[model samples]
Target chain A: MAFFILVIAALLVSVFFNSLGAVSLYRFPDVYTRLHGATKCTTFGTIFIAVAVVLYAVGRLLESGENRFWVLIIHTLVAMMVLLVTNATGAHAIARASHRSGLAPAKAVVDRLEESCSRGGASQ
Target chain B: MFIFFASFLMYLLLVWSGSGIPMIEVVIGLLMATVVTFAYKTWHPEKRLSKRGLDPRRWFGFVAYLFGPFALGLAKANIDVAKRVITGKIRPGIVKVTPALKSDVARTLLADSITLTPGTLTVDIDDAGAFYIHWLYVEDENPSEEQLYGNFAHWARRLAE
Candidate 1:
């Protein structure tokens, strides 16, 4: 019963953060800003979801008192690991694609990079 | 493969705790993981296990660079959004950014960094390595090319350099 409550709490927290992240993406001014909010909030929400799964596995293990607990725990851990790697890597790829395609800061006063790159001088 | 071996060991521990399983089962599992690991190693024989000679000073500087610029951008976007919402003025558009990052990894870092920030969403990319960003607020009739690429490249170089 306690475990079920924990799972529900975790789910609610994850959902709340994910929607907040989406709202941030919709409300913010540029690509970089939206990515920042979305990535962090989603990553946090993912962690909570993983936590909920772990809690459920523990509950099942306690109830069954059997070997299936290990399977559940290991699979959940593996999924979490995959999520951690893929999310950050995907975010990096998107960011690079956005930058090289020609997006700029809204109110940037100075742009040394543009000057240096255009002048055949390597960026320091 | 390591994961499989770990799983087998876990299985052994579990069976030993609950009900007795044949030792042959554990040995077979270990053999499978060993074979898989060796096969994987052969497929990537030259892969380095760890990056050596990492410069700590540069790495720490990069972390600070990302944190500082990202925070500033987020706060600025928050204010911009608040104003835009109150004024009922939003000119959403997609602008292309050509970040002249020399390396693919560096470019990728910049792209994700930009996407992670508020108010900006990465829409598409081209083979020549350009980013298309959707803006929630477009203040300029003709946004400069540097406007999209400069800020991201600035911190990207600082972080990745």
Candidate 2:
């Protein structure tokens, strides 16, 4: 009963975040805002899903005393770690590339990078 | 040596069965681990497998980071971004953050953490190790390091430096 409840909760959390992400992707004005919403929501949603899998594996292991479930838990954990690390790195790369390609923030008030670049050029 | 032993143990774990131990599998796993370890050493000769690399304190700090500030930041960022998305209220801009961490590994870790958390995306690292981050909501034209990263830099320094 507890396992089912936990699984249901996890499913709801993931679904909520994922739908919000998709909605934001459609609603946001620019590339940067869209990226922010899409990347973060999906990543957060995936974390919940990973948690659910880990919990299910643990519950199975405890119920049956099976070593295979233990392996499943460990592997799921490794996959979660990889997902977290790679998602951040990949987002950074995309943001950098977008900025370099001259996609400015839509409603930005401050442009520190521009100021810094001019100052750096003057000093050199 | 430590890398070889660790990889050998990992290989054994990967091949472990609930039934009986297999000597043949153990021998093959050991040989494979040794070969992989040697290849790694050849590719990165400067990276020696030292005791410091396996320090329990560092591992503890890393685990603490994953559970503590990182987890909190993820949740907070998600909520904040969700609010921004719903309300269309964002003041996005690029800002410079110069953390005191000197090591390359620590700096990279800090950059990755900042990019992962709360309305921040690490855009570039200059020659002087200053990070240029694209913030989703920029409150100030020139924000302090504390304003940008809270205690993330401190945690990165502890864990990686």
Candidate 2 at A68: error in angstroms? 1.7
Where is model 1 chain B poorest over a 10-residue stretch in terms of lDDT? B47-56
Best by DockQ: 2
Docking outcome class, model 2: medium
The whole-model C-alpha lDDT of candidate 1 against the native structure comes to: 0.61
Listed for every candidate in order, the interface RMSD values in angstroms are 9.0, 2.8
Candidate 2 per-residue lDDT over residues A1-124, each given as its tens digit: 5886897799799988888899998998787778888888889998899899988888887789988887777777878887888888888788778876777878877766667766773111
Clashes of each: 38, 0
List, in the given order, the native-contact fraction of each candidate. 0.04, 0.56
Tens digits of lDDT, candidate 1, A60-112: 88888777776677777767656745775676567556655767644443333
Query: Which DockQ value does candidate 2 get?
Result: 0.53
